[model samples]
Target: MSGQNCWGYGGDNGPLNWHKQFPFAQGDRQSPIDIVSAQAVHDADLTPISISYSACTSLSICNSGHSVMVEFEDCGDKTVVSGGPLENPYKLKQFHFHWGQRGRQGSEHTVDGKSYPGELHLVHWNSTKYNTFGEAAVSHDGLAVVAVFLETGDKHANLHRLTDALYMVKFKETKAQFKDFDPQCLLPKCRDYWTYPGSLTTPPLHESVTWIVFKEPILVSEKQMDKFRMLLFSGEEDSEKQPMVDNFRPPQPLKGRTVLASFKL
Candidate 1:
């Protein structure tokens, strides 16, 4: 997906076949693992993560072939996240969603083997140690991602703004200007989460992410979820159009990784 390999979330190019192109897909630290709450260890030292997006500004939204992502201006420390197993504040880079076509089986990560309808990933980089995002992406202590699950019920006002812009970038390689969007509106009420070391769910599946998956999921109306399924995986010029749904990868093996919970349960 980074180059011209044309990786996708379908047959021949789906998650199961990714290991052929990117060996890290089968690595020990692969992400989107099923978070078995009962088996997770409670760490008293894990701090509550505080996200400050007060000064955040959205740049643009694009259909990245894999998922629809909203980019943010990570300049002047405008937006950042700290605490919760983080040694230093990480700068917000982008946020994206992974969803299923029309069911409750879309999320990449699950809890006690239960998958959500969708999931959001807020990707960040360790600016305190890395010179650039590209350099940090491959480093062991480089990236941090906050994952929030999505359930159907009520429509989210903040998310509606994004849903409205989806029409502009319906096809792959398309983008639209989306400014002044604050990501804080998307987080769940509770900050308690499960933290573990894992790799990117996409190609080049770099094993450099420190994932923080929230315990509670946010709410979205059934109508709102329908908008996400309207996106296309193929470009506008392609003869055949493939709807971009069920873009999430399945949960991988835990491989004896110690999952730390931020709060005692």
Candidate 2:
């Protein structure tokens, strides 16, 4: 399992053994690092993240073997995130999640060694310079990902729109049309965040991401999290079935990288 091109978050194929196939897993700038607030350097010059997702068009939702992802219409820049360490506006491509088997520990990126129940990654591409997401994904400065932590608490009404559709895509390689959904409701109240350079937290683990991790976590009920756990890694046709839990990658070494903060810790 360790040498396989396709990887899962369990047993011999887990994060600890990813380096066998993905050399970047052992590379210098891996993602999901433990963000030490005390060590992060606050930069007053860092601009606020400006997101114009009011008209963001949602295309479909699919279970991409690894995680359930919601892809958007990025043919145009209707939905984009700019400012805050970004040289150009990045077009919103897709949004997905990572979680653990249980509600207590699931998020990929930790803060001061603390973990969250889940993490949301909103993937974007540098459309200004790249023709497509596939091309940008492998480029050094081609991608920007917005990461939001999910905590267990009150039910998030907005999350119901997606969770309700989870049953439609309970198995891998499944897809359903999802429309008119705006992601603003899923964001935390505060816009403050920490920024750094890192790689994708999955196989092919390209070191091409500009990560913006929010400081405050959004709330979701335990019941909602259970819905995510119900998703299966195996497709409906496969005789063997596996639940899609603990899909999150562990925090990698930060090396000598500096985490820049937009707000005071």
Question: Model 1, range 37-86, lDDT digits (tens) per residue?
Answer: 98899999988998999988889999888888889886767689999899
Best prediction by TM-score: 1
Extract clashing residue pairs from model 2.
none
Off by over 4 Å in 1: 1-5
Best by lDDT: 2
Deviation from native of the Cα of residue 71 in model 2, angstroms:
0.7
Candidate 1 lDDT (Cα, 0 to 1)? 0.89
- The C-alpha lDDT values of all candidates are 0.89, 0.89
- What number of backbone clashes does candidate 2 have, counting pairs of residues 3 or more apart or in separate chains? 0
Measured against the true structure, the TM-scores of the candidates, in listed sequence, are 0.97, 0.96
